[model samples]
Target: DFFIEFSRQGPCILSRSILQLLYLPLFNKVFGTLNFADVLKDAAKNFIFPPVLMPKSTLLLNPQAKEYVDTFLTHCVRPFGNLVQLCGHNRARQRDKLAHLLEDFATLQDEGEWKTIEEKPPPSSPGRDSNLDLPVLSSLAQHDKRVSQLRHGGGGLDVDSYHRTGEAQCQRAERVDAYLHNLSLKSDSPRPHLACFGTWILYHTLRVMIMYLLSGFELELYSNHEYHYIFWYLYEFLYGWLVSALSRADSFLTEQEAMAEIHKGRGTKKNKSKKKKTRPYGREITIYQALQNICGGFYKVHIM
Candidate 1:
């Protein structure tokens, strides 16, 4: 609301206004990409005492001249900052508290601080009756591992232009593959390995997305111009997303490659005798096999 109000008054006015607003929040508070907190503080201040815009010459002559002017029509860009106000302050406050707790939890996990707790050692004496039921235990363990890593290895995008070169993308792909290798080992179920390479027709979608992000990253932007929204914010997001995806692909492919050798016949099923064919259908091949076939055929992109 605050930013949009500035927009209606034209470029020079909006730029000067925000530049001045940025100068006001001098280290007493931290600002974010959205700067929601600062914007809200500014709005409440304006509501109590609205802001007025003055011409450059007028401001030089009397800096306080606009302060005396009625602010009835000078509330430029005051409403856009209410982006998430539908949720009352009470709910927002609770969310903030919960967020802090989650941050602490994540920090602990990242640092493996939980391992610091001393656990009571198991008795060395053998039990009168001992049973080793491994199948069920192993299955459960696998399920828990997969569930935990469901959202793992993903991170915020790398927006540093220095990180966007072709060589960098390749390196990112390698790191992603390394992480995936670890994920696959935890599973080693033979299912994910197959699934990752087995799907067909995904490249059609992935190629388009990759190109869109690539183009957005290359687009030129003008300072204080209209391109900031598209170029800086959206493009940065897409680039990050692209980097994340490349890593995932690298991991999946790496696992698929290892599994390809293990399950020499990745996976396949024959059609009925009447419709029997020497070659396997797309669905019949393992995921890795499908990916290999598709990439080679469409883009001639080979996956090692």
Candidate 2:
């Protein structure tokens, strides 16, 4: 309000008016009315007097000038300095207080200071059994046990001791046979030793025997080509055999039927009049004729 009033009148007019008001004894006397009575009623109450001394001091400091810089600085600049210092402090509590103070001062300018008070009780911790009450360890142990059980239970069938022993011996024999066979095959010439020749012949003979067993002896008899020749040969041989057997059985049945028909005298054929067969013209001639007919029709239409 003071600043607004100050701004309404030009600064020069405002300053001259304030200078004239400061020197006027009448203005001081008017303010002194309440103070004069307060002094009579109770001398202590006179201490709460209006701020008329500020302007009076400005007049004494500069009698020739209309305004003094110190009065303006004291009224405006000092509070701003206090605000800056309050804001600059490193303490959090002081900084927060200063911010609230600034907000109050900005809103309530020359009015009294705004005060805030808060009463909060100190914080206290919960009891000591909190960590032990957590279920993390128990849950982890259960998870681990479940994982271990799955690992053990998911392993495939376990062979018995006797079966494992027999399998091991068979595998060893197979490996030795393979090694000896490879060695014999790698030899430049046939050997005279009966055991060597016997082994060589046995290996190949066993291979052929196994091939026959696997292919049912059919592929060996029929096929000469080597690429899946065994499988196709075996398939063809089996199919042919089956068909031959079925045909033989069917022929026997047919013979029986024929004999029955003959015995019943129902097998004779009757002669019918014959008709000569006409050969059909080839598609090329038919197509050419169709094309000619289409062309002639098209030409006639075009001429019309």
Candidate 3:
């Protein structure tokens, strides 16, 4: 009963006091301090006089009084940037957790069951046949030929071909050195594309910071529904906008890189043979057509 009354009247009383403070100038000008203090004293007198409904024992042993006092103190208390510092600390913790989770997921992928299927066996076949099975055999032969052609002529592995397992540490160090050297030359060379890429990275970092702060607060202060809603709303808006902006930035960068490559004449070669041989029926009819022709040629064999 005491808790119910406190819950109902506590917020109302606090709200009225806040409104009165806001109109302090008008009250002071019109009624002066004497009338103001008298009104204030009367209000304070209500606290001294226990409620008729409130039991004497319950009034003396107020369970919610401490909470109310803490609430009042929290509202009145002023700190020099403490809230900002607290928020920063929470964001940092969240960032650390997110980083750790990503690292763990990567490690799990590297050590997972999918590694077992890295080796695959060649297809097997039984006995060979004569001219009767020529069409079927020819189709199988064509499929094999196509597979071999792709394996031998496909754009050869670039990164994996250069990657060395035993010397990975040494290779990584060399790559880092080269990267730093290129980065140092950027000021003189002025690669606008790389600058934009760096800016995009920074933008993503800020987005992560915002996400981290919101998630951290939601997890820690689950009871603060209003704060949770505000944080989530801000996070969703910022995240969506950042994602859209990043997508546009990525597309723009891709176009710039493509144009740069074109200017340098550094794109994949156009296969004239592939262009000419696109429509296969022009070159030679498929085995399926040949089989149908043979079947039609020997309708008597089908009857037998």
Global CA lDDT of candidate 2, please?
A: 0.28
Give the higher-lDDT candidate: 1 or 3: 3
- TM-scores, all models, native as reference: 0.20, 0.14, 0.24
Tens-place lDDT per residue, model 2, 183-243, is 4344442111112211221222222222222332232322222212223222322222222
Candidate 1 structure quality by residue, lDDT tens digits, 1-304: 3332443244464454454456333322224344444453353322221111111222213333323122211221221222122112232242333323332222212211111112232222111121211121111112222221111133112222212232222332233223332344554241232112111111212222333322333432122222222232222332333333333444444444444445564466533454332322223234434443443343221111
Q: What is the lDDT of residue 213 in candidate 2?
A: 27
Worst 10 residues of 1 by lDDT: 195-204
User: Residue 302's C-alpha lDDT in candidate 3?
Assistant: 29
The pairs that clash in candidate 2 are none
Clashes (backbone N, CA, C under 3 Å), per candidate, total 14, 0, 0
Please tell me which model should have the higher TM-score, number 1 or number 3: 3
How many backbone overlaps does candidate 3 show? Answer: 0
Judged by whole-model lDDT over C-alpha atoms, candidate 3 comes out at 0.30
lDDT of 3 at 17: 44
Name the candidate that leads on TM-score: 3
**TM-score of structure candidate 3:** 0.24
* Tens digit of per-residue lDDT, candidate 3, span 183-253: 43443332322222222222333343344444555456333323322333233333333444344344444
